[model samples]
Target: MNESNRKRGVLSPCAACKLLRRRCAQDCVFAPYFPAEEPHKFANIHRVFGASNVSKMLQELPEHQREDAVSSMVYEANARVRDPVYGCVGAISSLQQQIDLLQTQLALAQAEVVHLRVRQNASYSSSNSHGGFYAASPSNSGSPPTTLPASSRGKAIYNMDMVFDQANMGYPIW
Candidate 1:
């Protein structure tokens, strides 16, 4: 008896064949993508999509496109195992939600930075016109005296409390 023929049946089967408990032929379509080392991968796929269906899918596709088709099927099958109800759609929806949340946070942070820069510029301008900027609070004593240096006499004097009105701000960041 030839040694090749004797040992051929004992050759280590591909992951797909092992999980399906079937003979793995020399030209098995799943040999490349579904190596025997990682049985769990094919097991997960088989659990979701039966071995017969996978074989039919592989047989239907052209030889050149079989590898990509198997990869996509495995990925989708794994995802389906993780999320039974929505499968890959659930993962896609989750990722999209996270992206939207991150974008909103980024927008709010940018708005805050712009607001701070404007406030800083205003304070710097106020100080440059006079020796320093003074803050006034509306107290029971009386309305604070509205006086300005000769250089800023015609310029409008801004009140911090009034300037921080929520409606005046471009976006409601909070």
Candidate 2:
């Protein structure tokens, strides 16, 4: 056979053909994607999707899209093997739960930081003024201080209220 024919496995059967116990024709759909070296790739796919179904699927798609389709099929087949029922969905759900837990922890940490900053500012102003006794000013009483120190005024402050609100609204913060 010629070089192109040899590459197409006219001489040696492709993985799919070898697994199926059939000869690999020059026009075999599985030849390019399922080379002879990676028999396990086609084995899992065949066990999950079946050879006839895969052949039909590949034949229906354009040549340019076949490789990607095969890759997706392989991934799905592997996932299905690992998780018979939920497959990739189970992995995704676990990751999402982790994200939610981390976000909650982050929000709590941010609130604590805001609380500490307010307390520090309160103490600093008190110590500098009325003999270590906190005299709540008219602008500061009954509410948290909105104005930051002159050194911190130009920096972006984390608004814990907005973060809590967004967290309550079921949206991701980061």
Highest TM-score among the candidates is held by which one?
Answer: 2
Clashing pairs in 2: none
* TM-scores, each model vs. reference: 0.69, 0.75
Clashes of 2: 0
Give the lDDT of residue 25 in candidate 1: 83
lDDT of 1 at 9: 59
**CA lDDT of 161 in candidate 1?**
42
Q: What is the C-alpha lDDT of each candidate?
A: 0.69, 0.78
Against the hidden true structure, what lDDT does model 1 obtain?
0.69
Kindly list the per-residue Cα lDDT of model 2 for residues 1-174, writing each as its tens digit: 444876654567889999999978877899889988899999989999999999999999999999999999999998889998988888888899999999887877777676566665665566457665545664345443344568984455665346375567465443
lDDT of 2: 0.78
Candidate 1 residues 1-174, lDDT tens each?
Answer: 222532475557888888778888877877767878788878877888888888889989998898888888888998998899999999999999999879766655665775555454455555455565444333212323343457954454443343333444357643
lDDT of 1 at 87: 91
